[model samples]
Target: MKATHNPPTDVQVTPADLLRMAALYLRRHGWTQGTYYASDAPADNPTPPACVVGAIGIACAGHKVEHFADLDTDDRHTYLDAIAVLVDYLDDHYPIHLFDDDGLCIDDHTSPYSWNDDPLCTADKVIAALEGAAKEWDRLHTQGGEQ
Candidate 1:
């Protein structure tokens, strides 16, 4: 998916490191649209489910999410730790992350929202968003944009 708005030559848009990481990790692992993980006990999940925001959480966090299910008993703390890390990234211009689709009442920060999205969100759209976001970040940085 291309950028919806391309600014003038003097302007640039820098995406975050997490975007690139999410893309790569999702490509290597797998993506889930509607849930934080594909399964409640995701350790044995063959695909190792990861939604857009979850991907960002797992990618940068030193804590292994393979055992993330076990921490569900303390879900608040689990998410809190992840949120703490996300806060650091938020201090910068992480161009695109998870955004809620007001119309659908679901969170889909990918570009698939630009299209019909009738069949349902797929791994392909997720990957496209990650790669596209990464490219956009690189392009903006090359043009003298700050990360």
Candidate 2:
């Protein structure tokens, strides 16, 4: 899908905004974190899983599925492209580490935080990630404009 150049109307899209959008997209699809599994299907499949499409939607525009569902297939693909850009940006700047069921760090060799057991950790991470994205967005906007 081609990326859309249309920036969000608010001009102050936050990470939280993206997260909510992504969550909504995932919900529209059949993806649940609990049931998530690696898939070998092509990414551009018309009937892609909701979680995958949702993540792409989040990375592209911070809009809900209701809004996205209104778009044409090409537009949806463009939004997905935008999501790809967002994912690349996040991967470069705020890489998320995966943890095992026991709260042990699995992706990185670092020790797991004792606080990882607390639900607040998840909440805090979400807030912090979104805040960071907002800050980055502000920085980009202030420097020149959206990239």
Candidate 3:
């Protein structure tokens, strides 16, 4: 039998990058379109509820909505650490499905909206979602996927 090679298991990604990816995913899937806030505005004003849900959904799947408060921390240094914990949680749980266009369920692995080859919504899932969104944006604007 020929030897089989396995890819590395550990994924290294920053929480901010993950958030950016989530934002891109949300925009691509019609969650943040036409929703704008001033650059200096507070988080609550600019960050949509769906984005929060998506972040929580990805970080803590199947968790009750009320539990979000428990996850909040006062430690300034641990802010990104909190996000890292959530990203780690996504390694095992199905990511929160944010796309709801045409009543299509994109989160379901069996649904036509399911784009990734794998079922779990890990880092690859986020990346895939971002890539799909970029493609859709490109198709719409004819920007040739620049920037």
Candidate 4:
């Protein structure tokens, strides 16, 4: 009987790097583009709606710093799959903690805790969402087949 060869295991895709890959994916897919500004929002406005900026920030902060640019094709796919999971979670859960910038706290009308208070929460949530997503991606890839 012939034995199947296992794929090489020299490459490793880190969560931080995966996040960066996800950010790039968003950019490639027109999911994120352009500079974002909040000045036009009403001074009393509670929260800025979710936007590409948050997604981009999530990708930028969550990706692996050391191995971001260097991944084999298989590794890249694994990374992207993980990123996709994170993106999906961000789209669904949209956790407020993602964008919580304690330093940005202003007053009662716009406390970070409020759901409608800040975009920073989006960024913060990406990190948390990616953690879960990465594990799922890794499992899917290791087990076989696309996730």
Highest-TM-score candidate: 1
Tens digits of lDDT, candidate 2, 27-126: 4543422111215445555433434334545445443343566656865665644444445445565555678899987764211222222333443443
- Mark the regions of model 4 whose C-alpha exceeds 4 Å error after superposition: 1-9, 12-17, 20-82, 95-122, 139-147
Number of the top-ranking candidate, with lDDT as the measure? 1
* Candidate 1 local lDDT, residue 26: 79
RMSD score of candidate 4 (Å): 14.4
Better of 1 and 4 by TM-score: 1
Candidate 2 whole-model C-alpha lDDT, 0 to 1: 0.45
The lowest-lDDT stretch of 10 consecutive residues in candidate 3 is: 30-39
Q: Write model 3 residue lDDT over 1-147, tens digit each, in one string.
A: 336877779654434444455545445332311112223435544343233334333333222233334544432223344344333334334354435778776553232123122344333454444444334444444655466
Please list the residue runs of candidate 1 whose C-alpha ends up more than 4 Å from where it truly belongs after superposition: 1-15, 40-47, 64-119, 145-147
Stronger candidate by lDDT (2 vs 3): 2
The segments of candidate 2 whose C-alpha lies over 4 angstroms from its true place after superposition are 1-32, 35-78, 96-123, 145-147
Q: How does model 2 score by TM-score?
A: 0.32
lDDT, each prediction: 0.52, 0.45, 0.39, 0.43
lDDT by residue for model 4 (77-147), tens: 65445545565554445533333366653432221123323444443343344445555555665667465
Error of 2 at 5 (Å): 27
Cα lDDT, model 2, residue 66: 33
In order of appearance, the predictions have TM-scores of 0.47, 0.32, 0.26, 0.30
